[model samples]
Target: MPNYSEKPTIIFDMDGTLLDLAYDDFIWNELLPIRYAEQHQCSLEQSKQTLFSFYQQHNHTLKWYSSRFWTSQVGVDVLAMQIEQKAKVAKREGCIELLTYLKENGYPIWLATNADYAGLQFKLEETGLRDFFDVIVSSETLGHAKEFIEFWQILASKHPFDAKNCYFIDDTEKVLNGAKLFGIEQLYSIQQPSSAKAPRETCNYPMLSALTDLIPILEAQTTEQAEEQKKYA
Candidate 1:
């Protein structure tokens, strides 16, 4: 395992980028509503209405990604529920293939996820994605969601990296916009984040249909860099 630290750093989002968003979709969208109804002794419809309203109110905010925050607001231990369904957690298509390629080739890998620390911990533990990353951060730890430039600011402070020389891949458009604002040179989004959902038709940044789709992009960058070096020589 020779790691080429000089290569352009690659930052990834956890749930929706490297890992299947289907597990999260099942946890939040399908399972939580039923559990909320059971806990509150209400109809499933009522539970969904209440929860969906909360989602709309806080979507893309730091609170939106916190299991503890939801637990306190909804009277459900959301973290525990997610842990219970850890069996549903899975890696997205080509996730391991792409990561293995990067790791073997020496690209420094980092994970910047909006998932709270608890969620990040469990998912990484279950998926064994922790070892692949040199850096792992949770928005709950940063005090700002990835949708804000401040999050990138704080992250850069803690771990110095060249934003202009790095690539970031995430499923969320707002997160990509934040990284772009912070001067990240290359940003990408997933075409289909969740296995249970349809592929996204468009994104502001280039969309990766499969995780391995990034291989040729990186290879081409290396090729161009070599050609420039030869020209200078």
Candidate 2:
């Protein structure tokens, strides 16, 4: 449990942390390939193979998350596709309750993600999650992916938060490892980022099956903070 007298900043990863990742998976794996196949007049299998090859080549690079870059490479309107698939976007179970609790408690929450700004905007609009965050940071804005150390350095320089006090929850181990290497004290991983997928193997850090799991811990922390304030008073 995290109990901070100073009210630590809560940094959340957007895709798998707050929102369901099924939409992203569908967009990249199914929808994009379908559109690409249609555009190039190829079989679905051929389009998937070619697109996946491109994905493998650019896996960890900034290009992987760039809508503009993919639009040029894939010769299709990537953002338009995202907008078209916006109906599939949704918040993870218990995420809304968790966000409401954090907001009511006055925790300064920030959304940090590797999603391109356009995709991020579309998801935010579809899910209505934009207003819940105090600040939103995207890798596209910094020109680096979350897996790199420089991303954290740039984020710290721009946002300025105590690494030890901040709680960063992300679904990807690589991203969590990046934050840990950058000296973030508290880290959490999501067991099932996509509800359609089975739960993943246990990670090095603590795992959350759902955001609501932390409510009890957070409520306890709130009680502790109140008691401490009373002691001082």
- Best model number under TM-score: 1
- Would you estimate the TM-scores of all the predictions? 0.96, 0.92
Note the residue pairs that clash in candidate 1. Answer: 4-106
Using lDDT as the measure, the top candidate is 1
Model 2 CA lDDT for position 157: 95
Candidate 1, residue 178: Cα displacement in angstroms equals: 0.4
lDDT of each: 0.92, 0.89
> Model 1, residue 199: displacement in angstroms?
1.0
Could you tell me how far off, in angstroms, the CA of residue 106 lies in candidate 2 after the best superposition?
1.2
RMSD of each: 2.9, 2.8
After superposition of all CA atoms, the RMSD between model 2 and the true structure is: 2.8
Badly placed stretches (over 4 Å) of model 1 are 1-5
